[model samples]
Target chain A: MSNRDRIEVLFWGIGGQGLVLASIILAEAVGVYEGKNVVQSQAYTAIVRGGTSKANVIVSEEKEILFPQVLSPDILVAFSQEAYNANKGKLKPDTKIIYDSDMVKIEDNVPFKLYGIPFFKIAREELGIPFAGNVVALGAFSAVTGIVKLSSLERALLSKVREEYHEINRKALERGFELAEKLN
Target chain B: MSKNVRLMQGNEALVEAAIMAGVRFFAGYPITPSSEIAEGFSKKLPRVGGKFIQMEDEIASMAATIGASIAGVKSVTATSGPGFSLKQENLGFGIMAEVPCLVVNVQRMGPSTGRPTKPSQGDIMQTRWGTHGDHPIVVLYPTTVPEVFKYTIEAINISERLRTPVIFLMDETLGHMREKVLLPEPDEIKVVNRKFPKVGKEDYLPYKPADDDVPVIAPFGKGYRYHITGLHHNYKGYPTTQPEEVEELTKRLLRKVERVLDDIFILNTYMYDDAEYVLYAYGITARIAKEAVNILREEGLKIGLLNPITIWPFHEDKIEGLLGGKKKVFVVELNSGQMKGEIERIYPRKDVIGINKLNAELINPYEIADHVREGLR
Candidate 1:
């Protein structure tokens, strides 16, 4: 399992939670910054907010990658309980599952590692940014997977984020990384 | 020297390729799975002093492109499932009027707006039959992102040279998947513009075919004062209901595409020298079918693949000859048995089977492998 050459990741959340933004940042980091081949794809119905949304990103260091969806995700980042339930079946034996503890309750006897971070709580309380939770999850993913370097991730964020929200979201990412390192 | 290859989605590559092909006018409506083409053109066209218009609907979008093409501008329109359905009447109009333009359909799952943002190769037959008429059409299917760029350039050239509307038949997977593509510099590619008639205004007959069966097309505003209409017309471009003239005009319309059939037909065959079984596939499903056949070959089954690039005016005889002594031919597609019927019609004596899916997802290579294995059993 460890011999895998690509880090397949899926980000699941409701609309307006920056699900697509997070995946785009990761794809740009891996593809443009780290010089890895990447594909970032999103799924949604025709409607807009509060709808079920998913962003699938594949980062491969070697070999050409096709098909954007990760049949078995190495890392699953979920923001809501429904998001976690929707993608639980896509985890591999050694997969890593990360969800917001404030929003989702985990089931036991899973075949993979699990980490519950209070992503929403950290963003709203510590950072005073209500919607930066997705960026915080990106930080946590960088800390655990290490497939994407923090510098590359920051560069991607800085390039895409608007000037008004850049500083606060940057702080949120730092806090998520710091908290992620202390988790078992 | 070969330049550095930049990764591009099929939509992005199509835009860049169109610009390089000297396409100056684009009219389209934005729809999922194909909106990027309009966006790419909208952004870059202004930089190059070209034009892109977001029309109110697909019919007007397609019509505007044809109008631009007739006025001596290279033009194109892009759309997906429902939009493709809407543009059919105008597409037939382009056919009857002998208008040269390109129409690209980035296929999504659908009978009617089925899945807006999902990938499906369900538009194969639509490209051929969407328009209601006996008109001849050229449809090219690209399997990979880079080919999307390559075939798009080819589609425009064919439209201009053949003086007919050409379809760049792509699907949601290739339309959305980004990959490395080496965009050709302006000097490295061949671009074809419609052949303008040098004949004086009095002697020029608009529909007269050249020795090669491709008619010399004169731009409407280029002092080539001639009438054009959807009703059957003679070489003088005037509508006529006479039986003899109608017979000649219809034969010429069909023969124009048939004469260049060899030049337009394209397919890729793998391991078919003496294989017992052949898999016929196209668009995205064909890529997975290739993988499935490769695995089956290793597992000691004699299997091969025939992937078509020129979908319409299909190289039927090539397929018929290949399946000459084969035990079975499996046609794989994302829709339920669309291209399989074409395959069966071509190879009447061979046992034909269809492995199809309508789930708005691409059929996996493993699923194709399972089907091939069962067929062997």
Candidate 2:
């Protein structure tokens, strides 16, 4: 991508599903680790969990990230059917939609490029850590979009989480990368 | 460039800067968008040998901050719109008493609890005229996360140097947005501490003006004991109803800031040398304006930006010089034409256009670029 180009990503899901954490990891990877300018913002309900939560992460190679909110995101990662439904109107013809195959269902006639991954199923059944689904999604996003390196994401994740949880999260991320590779 | 770059939110930057500036006391009540400052200080202050108190309410928080400042500690209090209103009386007291302290208002939508989480520049005018008296105040608004960190230190320095209350105004957008900031090393940052009375205790006058029109304040518990009250006071700090004493005190308070306006006034200009259309903004709105200016510049339009880093004690001279030959000026804000009035007053000949957004939403870059396109056509 050109230095002037910016990639905008949106993570939408229930408040308990770790969408905010996913956005933070992505932003830190690109901004802190990769030395690119990034702006991350979120909108969530007042309640702690179960309400709609949305996080916007904009990564730009420019000297500044001028606008904090993403009006027309280039990539959308929806972890639930409610999130996908709520954000359908924001999609353009060239927008890329990444959804949880186990939770979100898209109509067949949609024009956007869609990638569905069973992040929840892999985290719970294979990894035995349901909370690791967000990391899995992050890995898939990095692999599919090439917006950030999977290695950088893992490093950012390890820096943010506790030492004891690092091994499981690393496995979850690798599982996601493998799943994305299979899809391609 | 200190390679210690970290992703920090605006609120977190404020706390970190305040602590670095020797802010040893923080008294605040939790309020949305501004609560992070309190929370961060709660965890970090004790480790740094500072104190953080969750006051019963905004009023108490303001009072406690002033009390701490009087005791010679660098103090701060953070709140949003409703809490800001509650702190106004004490804020005015701090002004009258010449207590050096920082008051951060992370502004959200409001008349009365309008939208706790949404961004707004509604407090732009309120921070200036909120208190019910004719007193001088310093208000600084930062447009970016790094600016937030830098300006917080500037706010504390100005408050200490001028012996007055400083308002660090931020909006919900900047308060919540996270960005990469190069954290400055301790020796790399310049810190200013309030000057203590140099004279013998027997000859010290608490309100006596020095060469800079600011009195050297002695901490309350110090040996140079003096009285302080919200009432107009004489040079010795005794309450006085005499017209001459009150007028002299008020004029000195105003003159201290006014005379040094050139030093305190801060603003940034972009592509303004040959521009015909100048956009004036601050806080998050200015960030969008910067992007809009870049887009318009690419499209071969002579558009530029003038963002006020210091919102109060208006940068009249700099703005007048910057808009010398500009034909039209656009004032973009998240309020209903608040700062636009100031622009109109300063540049009456120019057609000052106001692009206002008050719907609890941010004014996007596209909206501004489109507005400029339509206006040009």
Candidate 3:
């Protein structure tokens, strides 16, 4: 494997979108699969439902993580238009943007590369899953960033998710990986 | 060396260190900048046969922690500004009752919930005097993730050793920042458990001052019957109305911490030996001051940084030694002038300059360098 020092990830969504959970899963993946160090931070407001929350995770092969806030992200995933608009500028020059095209509108004129995935649609249509969009996003992130293996991401999800909803969520994550591979 | 270094945030490291320190009781409410501390501990506590309770409010949470501490368990609770305001009553109770507990105030922008989730170090004075009357408390301010881990363990040790409440005064910046931390092996680190009085119930005086003014505590249900209260009490644990009893009790309570100030105090000196300018800072401000010191050193300026991990009873002797014969001392903090006043009180004649920032953002290193440059002119 190529040895890059750190992988910075920015996961953005509304309060109810499980953005913090997605960041936690990513942190667990780095810790479990690659045995690398990970730092996860989230920003949210007092209002519970409609306010935007962003979880920024930084993974490094060998370094003590400091400054929990990500100054720049190599990978940016947005589940809402507001999240996209608020955080897209924080991406590094050559960073990748993955958004749920069903719920987000990405400007075509934007200079950086964009991967507009129908994450919500895939969760609902392909896997018949409704609340598994965050897991699907994580699957897509694992596939694109190649920071952690797919098996490890699946293990982390299984460990954290409720047992009752595990099956469809696992299917949703697999579908997300399939979709990302085909697009890439 | 374990070689088990991990990149963790300050909040995460606090939890990690607590686990390693055998902390089994955590009761806290979710308040910004400090909620992660609860979240982190909540998840890890169960894995280690510990309990994490999210109480209805900060007041109840702090009370619960004290209850657990008196029940012979290592306990802690974390909070931000407003929640800290709510916890002051119970904190005073802990001081009076001589409870071994840790209270972490992850400070945020605040007069009263000014900024729930933003960073500020304005609570230095509040940590010292928010509670009513005179009481001694050990307060340690950490600057980095590793220090957060180290000092948190130290806070627990001191609280247990001194039989008093200890404050891990964390700011939002340090609490939220991520950094690499080296975890010590299980056998390598020194751990201090609570000292239990060996005497039988008939002869025991709960408030009888032991050596070093630290009394051996007997847990509530440990079969040792003893009276406990927040009132001014005698060595025999009964409330007192006598003037001499109150005076002696009050003086010992304060002296327990004041006597050990030299042993528990610490400050970091960066290139201060032959410096012409001294920048004094703590918490997040210390990080920025170090950066400023480096930049000034690169420019061949005679500058140094004195970053204190122990904020309370500010390290008077060390400050004097470092500032020997220097005419200029710059004190930077996120608050208007909390610690600066302490520095001035310590060295009345020294040219103590205040580089104040209350903008809710951390003071920049460039500002310190500029102040030093201007002072030179």
Candidate 4:
């Protein structure tokens, strides 16, 4: 019901930034709406608000997911300096790394492709919804990687979030797509 | 129709299935990973006119679940490793009293509170013999969300039919991981209610075994009055000191599950027809081993997976049939070869190799594949 090759993605940021939700949104789009078998998990702990958190999503069109966790990620989205530092040295040469431009600053000596999108800035200043940055990042992820369609991501987000926050989240997602397209 | 196909966690799926299987009482002390089961029960049980209680401790949770089950409702409780340790004593009480309840242990790394957020199969030995007795227990180790859903119903049915506590095992990884599951419609499910006493109050013998070796005990607060104690009991349900009665009662407890292993066993296999080697695994390790089998098969190697969905009351007869002519069996687990020992007890240790991993991280498919390759070379 889906492609044969597996596509692995990782979302990393501080807790409460909604990276876990973003990963789930991407998983829902790929697995539920798009008909692939996917397994998504997050690093959980006693604290839910402040540590370096990670969400790993593996999309496989295989009959069953043999290895549930992402062994190597095709794309890595970082929202904090800690996220970048902890995971930057462990990427394959062709891995796509996207970091929040306003949140993390990196010198360009890495082997993989790096795209810095101002996810938090767009969510805070342009969209007036600070907490919608994860959706913004999801939009950027769709535009940059072309793994999930923008429509799929938007539908997933709309289906997951409440009605009051849908407008700003959609705007945030669109702005993410626009910025990512401009970067390419 | 509302969307049955949605993303959910393993714990959430189990609770949903339990409700469908007629589980109406949940008494649990929330712990990480397994806490979602309690949380789901808390939210959904009340909506269905059931009861959900956050007990003071895991022991109380087990006691309360047993109490509720004996009070004429299907009951369940969930806990993690440390809490599982705490519930062991009362769990034995449920076994001796022949109460039907479900105890879900979502394991984390631990002898104590080792790692709350990490995964472990450390409870493999504990789940079998944790309580201090020779009594039989039915323990199911499900690897995925869908299995959790299906086997939750199966577990409730088994416990109801057998009149014993069923341990439903999950780990931190499966409990927390999200997967897209198509929830089964209610009509597709067959709920098993426990056998209640048919005789009037005068002739009811609470501990008298029927043809199936299961006692149709009367529920508490009913018109029937009888003794229910942890001590060795007679057919009259009172504590007994007679050695023959204790032997008969004890033997009957085990015969309940042993006689029907065919009905309770669920062993999942992949590509077993022509495989030369076996990857023996359970829980999340089985999921990884299944992947390792696929990866090795792509390399033109004949490898297969023998996954035990039911971990305890080891289905030796079925497993023996599956592993008869295999070249080598690799018992892969998240702990230090707990089930490897069990497998070795059947097959010689020389024929069974152990692949062990116990840190917070999961052992990937490559690690398993590499083990097989290294062993072959």
Candidate 5:
């Protein structure tokens, strides 16, 4: 859909990567805290772990979200090489492309603003939690695009999981922000 | 909308609203996409002093819902396509017996089991005619999580007030998608219980019509003994081969809701006040059609959309008045022209066209915009 007025973000990976959870955090960050209209739509098959899953979050300042699916996302985060390749076509010329440097092998000639960040590596090494990689990517994502306040994303992220992981998640998020700042 | 905001799935919204609307008993078979509703009730019902039962199969679930309702409690049952099919026989029984209960069907793409996680509007006709014979049914199709919350209450209220079964239809996308909703306290709204016979047990005729064409049948176990049967029954609740009583029972069963269609029907129209063409859609398809309307509006095309939240007994005259001068009514659905035929039944046959997709994927707005552009040319 041609939702040029709204900010659309797509996070895609295998089924068990917490991509849907990341999108939910982003949606609540914008919709609840920031007081904007937002919708998060997901597509998945029957597969539990390896199947393809994509979550799209669309934010609007004025209009209610009628179309939730993101066909052309302004910010596309691919956590796997397969996801990146499958969704790279028909992107906006100025679309921000963020891919996991650890998992995605990319060609040199890409059209959009591309950033290859090893989100998984940073989360695993800095926080000793590989599963927290999605939160780190959200941190880097907030730093790069300012689609939502880092504090808003942090609050939304904390509410989604148990109490024990919050501290490591905070550090992981801060590390992602610090790393992205240095590169940009 | 209260300040008590929470993020929940569409199925959870329905369950919560059903409870708030005084649905105290649930009998259901859990299935994909719709399992969350059954799970929610299994957890929440006991806290409200309600009952939740997981039936052996869908048919038993349907029968148990009707049974629970007969015992003077508001009851509900939820399922998917396969379970919905299994529930059809008792659904007719509910219609025949004038039982008041809610049936939540979170439709997945299907002939049989089909794609468990994929969404579809394929059950549009099946829901209307799933039960055999001439039966009147009310179906509510809600497009969003919050809408599901609002309509679930309406469905229960309708069912109890009219003494008929109301079908709540949601697709897989709407069933699984999570969104923030402002929940109102149950005390803010007046919850209704079905009317009971005020006369002595000996004076009450089980199937006799009250002033509203609905029988003020007392619930079972209240000493107002009544027989509920699937066979065509007379006012005394006894089966009869007499043609007059059979015809009278059949007509009154339908007449209760048929006479009040305008009061109960809910149609949502957007950008249609000055439009020259209309898009007809519901469920998630209507959501995308609204986006297509925006796109077409930006291009200076005079197009709009009509989404009916009330899905059964299509109100042709009301819709015809709204689409009086429109060039065409595009029936956008995730099926092959079920509702297109329904709309065509209103206008001249060729004035309506079906914009359908059956790939088990949602139809995109750009595809709809392109089709409108082509149709106009």
Candidate 6:
């Protein structure tokens, strides 16, 4: 797992689910706060919402990030059933698959390590904000992978979101971290 | 002082650089992959006393940009594949009228309206000869986010200096990718403004040539009343049909850029000094080629990269020098052998292998590495 210096992460969900924003914050955490090289790119349908969307981010300790697209991602965070189904062919035997258990139901038995968290449920019931699911997924992913520090993620989120909405997101992130820690 | 390090996309960098380069007006239509430029300008331009207008379509946007430039304002417009096609007629008009403006084409996959979100380098030839007839234009391509910012300013500078419309060519990959960029301080960069006429109103020729064959552009309605048209024009900017007048104007227009090719052409070479194999690419493909060269070198292959920063007015001499003593040169691009055609013209006898990818996906580094290994074997 540590053979390569670069780490690729893919965030997949329907549009308007904040997957793109999550990818941007995650990239900012690693690239800006952690001072590593990063490239973040996204693909989505022409529709504004309820459309398949995916964001690919590559974080490298190397001086340069050559390819911006993630052909094979080390970590896949799925927020929708459609996203999981769409990316099933890209799954490798050792790849880590993280999905929202409340949103996606997996029928196929995959060889990779699969972890499910109720991201939407926690965001709505625990954090009182339904849109904070993306931040919760970020925290859970960080806790599971240990790729980027939670402090760095917090700082990146603070910088990205509006000043008025910082406290709610902070709570959402902390709840995510706690949930991931309990699961691990 | 603001911190120089900031996370920016290629489109954002272009807007920031244009603003810093004293661009006062932006007119553009929103299109996929390239729409961020218009969005960025809409917010940033107003703060700096500049104006941004989302025209009804690409044609109006290009015409309005030319109109702004004629009023002594540094103007810019951006678009993707189909919009670029719609813009070519007015782009040619800007060339003939010698209107200094910048046209940014963040290319997407297309012959017509191919792919809105996908990246392609298919517009290389379109930019060079898209408009009708014989005319000279400058086109700049940048591979990195930092180069996107730098070359955008360079595009504005060249346009103003040469009094010609400059095409700032970008791919959808670069346009959408986000990266960390250390923007230079405002005073750190060289900003060139257009040379306005200094003569009194009695002796002003709107189409008169300066020492470098580029005419000094005087803004319209500024007490310098002169005719400006797309037709063959004489020294006073009046329409001309005589053989000498038309011949001289055409020659001077082409000569202005041809004579200063050395000043405009920019290229970057990596590991070429002791390399046996060279990979020639531009834009996003060059970034991938750099990695491929690195991986092959670690495996002990003498591979190098020749990245063309200026795509138009092809760097023939520099490319020839880099190809010296190299056994094979792989021309890597996102289009089906667009740049490879130019390279073949330069080195007719050499083994110029073209690794072309046209499926709207980036050429991966592993693919390039494997090709190098195969070529060596």
Best by lDDT: 2
Compared with the true structure, what per-residue lDDT tens digits does model 1 show for residues A57-166? Answer: 88889745544457778888888889778777766888888788888888888777887899888898888888889888888888878888888788789877789878
- C-alpha lDDT of all candidate models, in order: 0.83, 0.90, 0.82, 0.89, 0.87, 0.88
Deviation from native of the Cα of residue B52 in model 4, angstroms: 1.0
Q: Considering TM-score, where higher is better, how would the candidates rank from best to worst?
A: 2, 4, 5, 6, 1, 3
Give the per-residue lDDT of model 5 (tens digit) for A59-166. 887777877677788999899888778877868888888778889887877778887789988777868888878888888888888778889888888887789878
For candidate 1, report its TM-score: 0.89
User: Candidate 6 clashing pairs?
Assistant: none
> Runs in model 6 with CA error above 4 Å?
A1-3, A85-89, A92-94, A105-111, B375-377
Worst 10 residues of 5 chain B by lDDT: B1-10
For model 3, state the Cα shift of residue B287 in Å. 4.3
Q: For each of the candidates, what fraction of the native contacts does it recover?
A: 0.16, 0.69, 0.16, 0.73, 0.47, 0.58
* Deviating ranges (above 4 Å) for candidate 2: A1-4, B1-3
- The sequence of per-residue lDDT tens digits that candidate 4 reaches over residues B1-377 is 12688889999899989999999999999998799999999999999999999999999999999999989899999999999999999999999999999999999999788988989999999999999989898999998888888899999999999999999999999999999888878999899998878788998899999999999988889889989999999998999999999999999999999999998988888898899999999998898888888889899999999888888889887888889988999989889988888888788689898888878678988889999998888
Cα RMSD (angstroms) for every candidate in the order listed: 3.2, 1.6, 4.7, 2.0, 1.8, 2.1
- For all predicted structures, in order, the TM-scores are 0.89, 0.97, 0.80, 0.96, 0.96, 0.95
- Please write out the lDDT profile of model 4 over residues A30-116, one tens digit for every residue: 888778888999888755687778999988765667577766678889999887777767778888888898888877777888889
DockQ each: 0.23, 0.59, 0.16, 0.56, 0.51, 0.50
Scored against the true structure, residue B104 in model 2 reaches a CA lDDT of 96
> Which 10-residue span in candidate 4 chain B carries the lowest summed lDDT?
B1-10
Best by DockQ: 2
Sort candidate 2 into its docking category: medium
Error of 3 at B33 (Å): 4.5
Candidate 4: true interface contacts recovered: 0.73
lDDT, residue B32, model 4: 87
- Taking all chains together, the TM-score of candidate 4 against the true structure is 0.96
- Kindly list the per-residue Cα lDDT of model 5 for residues B1-377, writing each as its tens digit: 22487767898899889999988899998999799999999999999999999989999999999999988899999999999999999999999999999999998989999988988999999999999999899999988888999989988988998999999999999998877787898778667679878889887798999878999888889898777899999888989889999999999988999888997899998998899889999999998999999989999988899999999868878987887878888899999999888778778777787899998988988899988888777
In candidate 6, what are the lDDT values of residues A1-184, reduced to their tens digit? 2227777889898888898999998988888888888999888348578888889998888667777788777899999998678877887788887789999888767787787899989998987899899999998888888888899899989987898899998888888888888877
Best candidate (score: TM-score): 2
Docking class of 3: incorrect
